[model samples]
Target: MNASPQFRVLRSRATETHNNLREEILAALESIIFESYHNSFTIRADLEVAFAAEVQSKFAVAAHSGTMSLFLALRACDIGPGDEVITVANSDISTTGAISQCGAIPVLCDVLANDYTINTDLVERSITDKTRAIMPVDMHGHPANVKALRPLADHYNLRIVEDAALAAGACDYGLPVGAFADVTVFSFSPFKPLGSSGNGAMLVTNDEEICDKLRLLVGYGHDPLRHGVKDGYQNYTAEGYNVPLDALEAAVLSVKLPYLKEWTAKRRAIVAALQDGLAGAPARLPSFRPESAPTFRSYMICVDRQFEIYQGLRAAGIEAAFSYAPPIYQYSVYAGAFPNSNELKVTDRLAKELVNLPITPEFSDSDVEYMIETTKDLLEKT
Candidate 1:
């Protein structure tokens, strides 16, 4: 069966945006080829400046991916083996993997049913003497309850790392997503709100000491200058990993950053349209908190008959997805890694019911209407 005309039209618009960016990317590559001398540090510095301006932070460190950004942030804060980090269960497995890579245990907490963000109450209850930090993931562009979570962290003397990968342009209570946490990480993968042509991620913090340590950690533990130390010259510091973001990705991100707000606004508008259209449908729309403005990274709806609906949407030639199905806790790798794995009730429920629909600046009003109508029809039949 052919895709709905509305679906085809919007998909074509997305393709056009991608193709235009590809052309710009090729032009950038040609310019780089012609340059007599390319200094990577100079490019990094420029990106740092651009990121600081965008997020209103003192320092921003670019890395190869968001996973590395999280690892670097945790390492900077001195979290490692024998420590536990409290985080949401309904998140990408990369969050858990990053914690594991640091040799820290990830204590998964259930999310709020409405927003799918970490339940601050569960986060507090999960804390232990071994707990080192609280990493709150801003799922699908909605900022977590940072104000409430920050106080909880302070009470426990724990650091906070905001996983702002899906929330580049989102803000909570007028503050940017990166503003409140001790350290915040943002991903610029092709699907993110502020994406580049390829993969990139960044860490931002107001603490100069943490920023300094992160710079060394992401740069293979070597001091930038390689200056003299007690024994002739010693530049290497802590044990670290090489996770620098490439120059090309940085350039592309710089180009895309300026349009992030506009793109995010368009996404939010689409979400509103979807909500209006699905008012009488069986699907449960995600609740928007007035205090925080979501950037709508992925427009998700929870519905009964999730699997059937997912298959139905695909059969109808619409591109829909199950975001984070088989919650991180259900992964084989996490089978017995932690003790309280089965406590994620809400996470389990969401994993079984959530469905993400097409959400992009390229999606048109008619496209959203078709999805809404198709979904209602599918649900009625089931």
Candidate 2:
């Protein structure tokens, strides 16, 4: 009988990404520490410009986290008290929480069984006289069909705030994922595709009005009227929060941003290999539309025995995670908050079955092979 393969324990992808960029990150830090003295905002501003250019947006606002970016985007859209924003229930709490934070209601929309993104066809039906915005999450780095929702949002005079926290380098319809939304947010938390050492995010928009609102909200409502005045007097136009992106994190992200495309390509290749290796292996892989090009945060696969497979992978030294299951609406914190939760049949099914397998640019070809073989063995037993 053949002996079992000894696989290296895969830990955090973010750590590997950081280790890989150690030199560049150190150089950026050195420059910021010595040269940037008292001009810390300039580092963040440079990142915002580079990020905006990369995402093909007219303006970008850097924020402390993706959650804050979502909130700022919602506020920029004037979504508040009694307004309803349609979003999916299968995403992280940040998606729904952003809407609720603004005193607006989040109308739960179910996701597609295949891609696990918001079912855009059903989004319009959720719209009401009070519907103010549509927030679609690109769950597991799969690009939601925001392009389809663009016309719907325009017709309803609604705003689309895409939560692409996991999809910084993804593209859809031959353009970056944010191209179709009024404002799109990309996260730089360590676990994301293009990650910084600490929490950071960028909100990108083509609308000058929305851009101004985001800046105002991020800078403690510092008067945009006096933005070009050059005077040091602090003035306020509206009540807002101070949550600008951390300058040091911005420096790290600036060093990493140029390598995003390369890392994203590596992620896609890893998913491709996983897709080919796991085919017909008692697990269901996610499907994407031809126009969608996704960068995987982790390669998600659904199986009948999610927990068993997840545990088995961990035992075999693969860092498989069982999360986002049972749906967010089922969480105790949300108990009875979303009465329409029962209607999310597909979302419920996905949450119960999904398991995320780690994928990183640092993964070796042998590492991917080990993952495939080990997961296939686990799935076969289940």
Off by over 4 Å in 2: 1-11, 223-232, 340-342
Expressed as tens digits, the lDDT of each residue in 140-214 for candidate 2 is 889999999999999999999999999999999999989999999999887788888779999999999998889
In model 2, the number of clashes is 0
Which candidate has the highest TM-score of all?
2
- What TM-score would each prediction reach against the true structure? 0.92, 0.94
Q: With candidate 2 superimposed using the best TM-score fit, by how many Å does residue 227's alpha carbon deviate from the native?
A: 2.0
Error of 1 at 255 (Å): 0.9
lDDT tens per residue, model 1, 1-382: 2224544422223345657677765665555556633645566668878887888999888988898899889989999998999988778888988889999999988888888898887777788899989999999889998888888889889999989988999988888887889999999877778776568999999999998898888887876554346666567787778888888777677656777788888988988888898887887888967898888877888988888988888777677778778888778988888784438888898998998876888776787888888878997884
